[model samples]
Target: MLQSTTGIERLVLVPSLLRSLLMYLQLQKRKDALACLKLWVCSGETLVVSLAKEFYNYFPENEYKLCNFYGSTEIMGDVTYHVITGMDQLRHQDKVPIGLPIDNTIIYILDSNYRPVKTGEIGELFAAGQNVAAGYVNGRDPEKFVENSLAIDPMFAKLYRTGDFAKLEKGTIFYEGRTDSQIKIRGHRVDLAEIEKAVTSIDGIGKAIVLCYQPGEINQALLAFVLTETNITEHQIEEALRQKLTSYMVPQVIILDSIPLLVNGKIDRQSLLKAYGNVNNNDISFQNGIDYKGVPKDQMHAAIALFETIASVLGKAARSTISIDANFYNIGGNSLNSIFTITALSDRGYHINISDFITAKDLGHILSKLSNDRKNAYLSGQTEHDYTSELLKDEYKEDVLDMITTSFYEKADLEQWLMPNIYVEDYRELIDAIWEPLVDKRLSLVVRAKNGEIHGVALNFDARDEPEVEIKSQLNIVFEFLESIEGPVRDNILPPGKGTVLHSFMMATRSTLTPGENVSIMNFMEDEVLKLAIERQFAGIFTTNTSPLTQQLGSDVYAYETIHDCQVNLYVASDNTKPFAKAPDSQRAKVQWKPV
Candidate 1:
């Protein structure tokens, strides 16, 4: 980050070299970042403390910084996680995050009456940001997005109402558990009450109540609390589940209990916690450590099998072999496979998390990360000394820029990163490229911003050319700016043409950037493009993903067939006699994403 007032900057190294530099920064005593290079050496998911001890030569992390991210499904994936500097607070009492929100994002911990609660009190986490996803559409009900209206902020455009819990820590965010019962373990979300209902419904179970407790001393192994009149052992329950449940849903334990609830009618969970507290996530097979070849070997058959498995699950074709290094997302991996992959790992005795592939370079890297994670889950927390770094106070919490790009047809080997070209100076040259697509029409351009300091410039390119423009214009301004950049736009940005790709030629600020800035510019740009598309009367419609710009579109300009892939995996108790059986399932949402 620019430590001075001058924010404009340039990168001189290649992306690979840049990665090396980043690794160095991460290793610095001051940079509080994890050593990802070291973390990737092994299979990188579902790791346990026991496995790390067995293999400390490879898996060594500062125990003090073992953070656990938490938030809601409605907001972005993570609102807060455990922190290195605050572990002492948690050991004494429940310590939550008071961390800084993401760039251009806001969080409002509101009370039931929709008002701000005291700093230390509990409330729902309400978030607002460009990172927020569109509202859920399972039914006709509008109760989900009703957390509150968008409250404008000085720096960010608006704040979203996250239905999760979070608190401020120093300046970073520390997350508590959710306001409701929604919980995600290793990235797989399951309702405890729902699981209990299913368990009780089984023939022999008289009553059941599922309880989730932090693994602490006397904490039962990561599992389910079952109360059944029939003397069914854990083995019997597990055997029953083998036929009916997906491996990920299985509980590690199925304890016999005489008392199912307390006098207050609540599940007597404290006694259970006291009985088997501090249970580790290691009771599963995936936590035992699995070895995988880092690179996809000449196993044409293995790649084919993987592709087939994924395709069968998603009903897509997999005749093509995916590169071992190819990302699942850039290639169009959706949420279905995201969930399916967890079950897939558990099917193989591997526990995994969603972040493992959030920007995974390729299948090989992900396979490696998953391998490590499995063997290292619930390792000793980071030590306090390790968390006392300058980087914690001021560090660039970087997220890999995984960009994907395509044209007309879907492309495999999804390898696009929206990056800057080495020589681009400004956005104008980028805009100039659009002129090529608009040469035939009497083109007029529109650039948006409050002042002449432009944020976006639209080349009202006319796409309707008879034979196409024979000669490209040297006067193209946008293309020149693009060519001057140190690197071109990363693959993640939209292609030049789209159903309608709306983007600022520059980084649009959360506040300064408004739909009005885009609409007026796009309106004129479309008029010019309409001349190119040869649709003189095409002023009535436009389409794009739901965003500030898209939200600005007239109510009639909406989307349809927004494909959502769904899946429901019935899990079982690994140590139980009749753990999981073919269980009832719920289709969560259509999956989105492909390996880029």
Candidate 2:
């Protein structure tokens, strides 16, 4: 339809990245239709890089130039502009940023402290420009429109907070996500915009809309509606998402023919919520409570068959309808039901790695890849590490106690604040008291070096069920410090509660010849702790002692929240879970029903 648009030289409008790419693709095929369209000016939402590539591929690079503009309704429009040439498009292949601020506009990316954030750090975007409106009609929103006291120029003292999260990279500002749209799932902070970016990055995916199944709750799950022509399963999409995002950040993919849009052409989020509001996303899997009788003889065939079954389940179609080349995503596969497919395959003794499945070209390709990986592992004589892992033995009890006490005493001078004398002695006593019980429950690991010397020891077990006077006192002191943290910090700390807490009593490492050996031992112990947590389904994990290695490990892998007080550093790994500090309920607007 757009192929006949003659003499349309400059396309200056707000067309979605997907829509624009489609038009360009159709026009490029005819060689007449978008030929006149040069200097494509786009603004409205941030453009995804994949969509930009389509434009560059379909249209002549020298002829057509893409411009990305950024602005808000309050700031009129087109405050900042970024000309996307071949170089700019290639440079920002992941995301096409909003570029620099306009000539007269003063922009600031400030954190919650209202201080400028480092480059690439996400912060609230503020704009102070001539186009910025003075105030609302009735009265200015104090939160949105604030006096820019930090401004160097006294003339531009007023700045409007856009409530949009953005990251500045080399003078270019990339939209992260909206502050109000960001939500917590499984205690992890999830940016819907980040998810949308990942979704649109997929080869066949056109657009994505991610939403929180439930807001402001622990059981909250993420749901994603994706528009794509490729046959992709939920699990396959999930596997891809897992590579880009954390486990909690991966949303349940739902294939939609088209996104529900309002009259204004914006996504109708309210209508979407109303439709899927009551559906329990956690139980959206198709393999839930299904009984299977037979397994395929060929391993490769079995893997492909599993994917086909998963596609059928998610797409609500018969297995015969699915083709070998069809991707799971195009066939109604979603992340919510991918787990079931994997589980079903695992049940049949075919252990397929999710990572391989995510990047597979097609169903047959995934099965062949899985088969090849297994053959390669077998042919290469690959085997698990021969490291000894066992419960704390009665004979080594004294040795274990001495190792921990000696390490603490030695490191006390350096970390006196963290390794207080009282806490050290308390830890020793606690370990001594629980040694026998822990041995009975098989809850400790003592690793030895190649020279037969004790290298490291880690004690991880659920200790929430029974709490003695000493333990209770220690917890009370920790809780007291948390309480002392008045204001925002207090709210961000993990709340005190009891729900299967795994305590790492003493993770001590003996002096090694090299720092690399020490790191290896530490990593091995961390793996053990993670295994225990996964096996026992621990809601939270804690380390009584803190070291540089453990602290970095916590922040890097498990998202541990550290509490610094009482001359002791307690590290809590609750999936970096923090309660949202909400405004006072009384301050919210209220509407009362009056008699008609």
Best by lDDT: 2
- CA lDDT, every model vs. true structure: 0.36, 0.58
**How close is every model to the real structure, measured as TM-score?**
0.24, 0.51
Write model 2 residue lDDT over 334-392, tens digit each, in one string.
Answer: 33234345445555555454444443455665555443344452233223433455658
Off by over 4 Å in 2: 3-8, 15-28, 137-140, 152-155, 278-596
Q: List model 1 lDDT by residue over 503-567, tens digit each.
A: 22211111222222223333334333334334333222222221222222212112222222222
**Among all candidates shown, the one with the greatest TM-score:** 2
Report the number of backbone clashes for model 1: 149
Q: CA lDDT of 17 in candidate 1?
A: 29
